[model samples]
Target: MNIALVTGSGGLIGSEAVSFFADKFDLIIGIDNNMRQYFFGPEASTQWNQDRLASDFATYEHHTADIREVSQLEPIFQKYGTDIKLVLHTAAQPSHDWAAREPFTDFGVNAVGTLNMLEMTRLHAPQAVFVFTSTNKVYGDNPNFLPLIETETRWEIDTNHPYYKNGIDEYMSLDHTKHSVFGASKVAADIMVQEYGRYFGMNTGVFRGGCLTGPNHSGAQLHGFLSYLMKCAITGTQYTIFGYKGKQVRDNIHSWDLVNMFWHFYQNPRPGEVYNAGGGRYANCSMLEAMALCEEISGNKMNYQYSETNRSGDHIWYISDLSRFKEHYPTWDWTYDLRSTMTQIHDSMIERLAVTQ
Candidate 1:
């Protein structure tokens, strides 16, 4: 049977993968232990999304297993054996602040857990295309060192810089920087994913994602920036901005767009290829800009405050350059821009809140 195994199957990207690949794969196996609750708290639990996927897709099989434990993971790999045609590793301890609170858990989940998945795929499903959801944090604070010009609402690269038009790319250095504990762990996993492809000759692809978000995200203050910001706007909760004059910038990509990229890559099968994935010049905004957009969509003023301290290793200006990926996959183009993305998030947040109430 053709099967696809998705770790963190309840997450924004993982859930998207499940739906996107449901028709392509004969069976969709999802392994998640609701570890988002363990990392962020009960409110951040992804059990809701898990249930939704189980109900929505007849082919989906849910497995409550942690990627960190080999015992829990091995049985599934052995069960599927060579039938697993695709393995999407999207589960991660995804917050820098939370990582500082529990370094061991962060490293274990982000680094060692990735190794576990890679090894399992190597042993049982060596032919499967392994796609890892790596973060731009793999570049750490390196992007902050770029020549930037601060405007009233956002920070932009110097107009004269080559990156001004397209934004940062994979050519940027990934060394001698302050990668937070979370980023450090991701770096380990990112390199390992690449190495597995290069050394083992496994069909692996590493995507260094910008702000990955969608309605499905279990939005929390520690992560899922866009989704959480919109939630605060809709709920009238006080949102806090930490440093950079609330002008720090990020490129945002909807989960569908990203997972679609995965589908293209899975079809082509690249080994050890790393791509910088984000909205690029098509969809990017600053904290202040995002707040204004949220208010416009939700018709509620964002209650917000600013703190002088920023998160460790946070980027002041980061817009991904998708030239490499685009050059490779010319057929792929962004379908959701910033406004459309925020609008969808706004509607989704309203529905989710109403359901809970």
Candidate 2:
């Protein structure tokens, strides 16, 4: 049987992968313990999504197993054996602030968990394609030091700089900067993913994603940038903008688009190849710009406050340079733009809130 194994199978990217590959793969095995709730709070819990997946897909098998525990993961891998054709590792401690609070938990989940996944894939399903959802945070605070210009609403790179046109690419240095506890953990995992591919000759691909936002995201204040912002806009909750005059720009890529990138990479099976993934120049916004768009979409002015202190290791203006990925996969491109994505988020949030109410 052709099985697709998705870690964090209830979260944004993981759930999207399950849905996208449902018809293609014979069976979909999911591993998730809903650690998100522990990392954030109950509001950030992915239980609702987990239940939804259970009810939606018969092909999907859910396991409340922690990725950090090899004993838990080994049984699943051993049960599936070589039938698992795809291993999409989307689980991680994905917050900069939360990571600082619990360094051990963060490292165990992000770094050790990733290592567990890589080693398991190597031992059990060596031929399966492994796709890791890495983040732009691996570059640390390097992007913040770029020659950026302040505009009326957002921060932008200098017009004359090469990155100004295409945004930051894989060539940017991942050294000599404060990477925060979360970023540092991710960097460890990111490098290992590449090493496994290059050294072991495993079929692995790493995508350093920008703001991975979608309707399915369990948006929290510390993470889920666009999702959480739109949630605040819809619920009339006060949203806080931390530092950089709220002009820190991030390119937003829909979860489906990112999963689609994974699909392409799986088909081609590039070993140790890394690509920058995001909305790129096509779909991006500043914090202020995002708030304005959220207001426009929800038809409610966002309740927001400003803070002088910015999150450590945060970028000022970082739009992904998708030129490399585009050049690699000529057929792949973004399907959702910023406005369309935000509108979907607004609509979806309304639907979900109504259901809960």
Candidate 3:
């Protein structure tokens, strides 16, 4: 039986992977312990998405297991053995603020948990393509050092800077910056994923994602930027804009587009290859711009307040340069732009809220 293993199976990206690859793999094994609840709160629980996955796909097999525990993770890998064709490692303690509250949990989940997955693959399915959804936080606050010009609504790179035309690329240095506890842990895992591929000659790829968002996300104030922003807009929740005069920018990539990129890499099987994944020049926005867009789409005025202190290590302006990934996989292109993505999230949130009410 061909098995595709997805960690964080109930997450925004993981659920997308399960849906996208269900037909390709004979069995989809998902490993998740609903730790989002542990990391954030009861409201951030992903049990809802897990139930949806179980109901929606016949081939999907859900395992409530934490990636940090090797024993719990190994049995599944042993069961599938060589039939495990793909491993999508998306499970993470994904918030910088939350990480400070519990550094051990953050490092254990983000760094050690990744090691467990990598070793399991190496032992049971050496040839399986391992895709890690790493974050641009792996670059830390390095991007903030770029020459930037602040406009009325957003921060823009200086016209003369090399990154101005396409935004930050993989070539940017990953050192000498404040990475936050969350970013630091991700850096450890990111390098390990690369080493597993290059040193051990396994098929592994790291996607340094900017703002990976979709309707499926259990959006919380700590993470899931676009989804949470739209939720606030729809629910009339007071959203706080921290730092950069609320003009900090980020590139947003829909879950479908990112998972499609994974599919391409899985098919081609690149080893130790890294790519900066985001909406690129196609879809990006500042906090102020995103708020306006959400209001326009939801037809509700966003309740927001500005705070002078920005989150530590947050980027002022970050648009991913997809040139490397595009050059490698020319067939892949974005299907959802900013407006479409926000609209979809708005609709999904409305449907979900309606169900609960």
Give me the overall lDDT of model 3. 0.94
Candidate 2 total steric clashes: 0
State how far residue 144 of model 1 sits from its true place (Å): 0.8
CA lDDT of 303 in candidate 2? Answer: 99
Question: Over the stretch 68-155, how does candidate 3's per-residue lDDT look in tens digits?
Answer: 9999998998888999999999999999999999999999999999999999999999999999999999998988888889999999
Estimate every model's Cα lDDT from 0 to 1: 0.94, 0.94, 0.94
Let me know the TM-score candidate 3 reaches against the reference structure.
0.99
Please state the error at residue 13 of candidate 2 in Å. Answer: 0.4
* TM-score of every candidate relative to the true structure: 0.99, 0.99, 0.99
Q: In model 2, how large is the Cα lDDT of residue 243? A: 98
What are the per-residue Cα lDDT tens digits for candidate 2 across 245-315? 99999999999999999998989988999999999999999999999999888889999999999999998
